[model samples]
Target: MADRLSQVSGHLTNSYGRGLLAGEVAIITGMCWRSWSGIGRSAALLFAKEGAKVVVSDLDEKKAQIVVDEIKAAGGDAIAVGGDVGADDFPQKVVDAATKKYGKINHIVNNAGFTFDRMLHTTPDDAWDVIQKIHVRAPFRLIRAAAPHMRFKVRRENRSVINVSSISGLHGNVGQANYATAKAAVVGLTKTVAKEWGGFGVRANTVAFGFVKTRLTQAKEEGASIEINGKKVALGIPGAKDDPNAQYPHIPLNRGASPDEAAAGILFLASPLASFVTGHTLEVTGGQGI
Candidate 1:
């Protein structure tokens, strides 16, 4: 069974909901349709169900709106703000919209990014730059843009910011030199922000994922693709030469994580449950590193 937090699972509409995030305003980047949708979308929806008003960002405006619509249909309040997170101006636009719509920003999830796999000596400069821009630079800019808004609410509420990393970044992986570098950079950035923002009561953390079931994990032969910065890029789990499912059997859990299951750790970091936690990297790998 999938984790309840991963599913709607009586949490959103159920009377049993903890309302863990009651009265919070959240901004989740990369939450929409297509490749970047999995974890970001689940986090957005889960946050809303916990009583947050969300501002969701995606590269595709229409795709962003689709997720926004789903939130509203479920009786939650949300809005779509779409743009390339790698762009210099896009982060500010997303932060501005969230504050304008919700009166303040309390949570930010810098989950917008994609993998560009290649060996170090063979990777193209474009691939290296694109991966870095999306994974490292984008999150840095978004957090920088959202921090000021969150500070204003620091005394009133425990503001939180969460960045998404991956197992490839943690233990390192073949054919992912670019992703591994950027994600490792994210660990440093997350810890730095935690110290800088802690005095203001803002908690910053990174949720490093193992293998979550998403288009990124699909076998290359599945022919999955995503449009990023207007270029079609291959989307897959990186090491799959044959069966994509081959990687899962090696996982300690003996299964890949559901999107919602991956998101559950993120929500905890973003919610009051992790009020004292910051500068921490919560590995959601089902003991993959062990």
Candidate 2:
């Protein structure tokens, strides 16, 4: 499955040998654990293959080290930095680590985030605050820290910022009020940062993803099979078990996207291909909302 997915990705980019991101350094957050491997790992590998050095950051040291090991085994340049995104000093720490190792920071992917399932009335205040801190506060702080570094790089080399948002933010989902609010704020941050930093050759944008198979989705699928809150809500579509294409019958594309597909969109926005693109939200949902 991994090999097949790689082939699909190679064909999708079609610029494997061009080195579009050559000499660049990208920091990817939320890249720990098997569930996040698809998007975060794929992005790290792809960036390296394109001649960019990578900084893989995650809250889980073990998982983050695994990603770094994989990249190194592939003969790519990378390092793992483990720290909680919700930490007050995490942003500065991330920037410091990236600069110390790579000597410069060029791109950032704000992807580290998760949310506990709870409806508004059922959510506790602590849970709401934690969700917001992780999803919104952390990303914004990281961008703020990276801004000056990016500016310095631009004076010497251009840079970009890719913030990961969600469809839940665009069209709210039940039991995701706090998560949605945080993600929506990310979109707003993306635009504002793009506008403020454009002159410095720093571009910012967001990627809003829909259903994608990951550890989180798998857990949700398992939980959905059993009754929750006195309701049997099917996490996955009825026929998705056998036919992957059956998952999104209502979507124009009729299927969910792979993590690599989402990563490709991030790469595009970060590359010269999107030199003039900023403050945009690229939906990697197979046309689900359209």
Candidate 3:
């Protein structure tokens, strides 16, 4: 019995570990500080675990390096590229970092963004502009910058682009006018990419996430904040799920998703498992709004 169990365990490990994305190179953006368990960091680590060389990008070089170090400690290959995604020149920098180090690009995940929640009437021009720049424009620029590497290849390779969206974008949210618009634009952009890049066999998709337990979803009163464009913006809800009277009757799962869970959805879209899938908006919402 012991020998049989050992054989099964060994087979499972060998078959699964370092196989899904072997020989693939991936670039992931928006890996936040270590203190906040963001989905981008989770996806970076998970992709490395699956045998892909990873490029981790974040606003803070030290924070991105932390993720790279973790991947190395786990016997995976990774590098850190820190920059502001909203910067016009930064998207090209990210693509350059990947192509220079790995010599190719197989996957791209545009996951760097933050919400500036406010009613439509009260939302300022800067707030709207920043959100659109980060969530929509950055992804567009990155994809365009990576065109020479990903498109018009002599020998076609399986490539993918996974753009992160929000449930609010699918079914509007209060006080998220700017955020919702940006996310909705992501879906349109992804579909267009799918159509335009299909001839080259490059897949583009969007993952619209529900409530996830990241810094973005924490209690605002906790004082967690992030600086954008030389201004500080508070993060999270006030009561959130911690409120004694709060309940999650809307979500069939009855709870928010973890960063790891959200990352899994991104992984699926980037992996060869979704080779035949493109221009799809995968909703990782725990059945919410369904």
The TM-score values for the models, in the order shown, are 0.88, 0.84, 0.91
Task: List candidate 2 stretches off by more than 4 Å.
Answer: 1-18, 153-156, 221-245
lDDT by residue (131-224, candidate 2, tens digit) is 7888889888998887767765333254889999999899988888988898899999999989988888788989998876654455453444
- Tens digits of per-residue lDDT for model 3 on 136-255? 999999999998888865433558999999999999999999999999999999999999998887999999999888888888888877888789988888777654345689999877
Per-residue lDDT of 135 in model 2: 85
- Against the unseen true structure, what C-alpha lDDT does each candidate score? 0.82, 0.78, 0.88
Clashes of each: 1, 2, 0
Between prediction 1 and prediction 3, the one with superior lDDT is 3
- Model 1 C-alpha lDDT per residue in residues 105-179, reported as the tens digit of each score: 888899988777888899999899988899999888888887678665333365888989999889899889999
Number of the top lDDT candidate: 3
Q: Which prediction has the highest TM-score against the true structure? A: 3
* Segments in model 3 whose C-alpha atoms lie over 4 Å from true places: 1-18, 153-156, 242-247
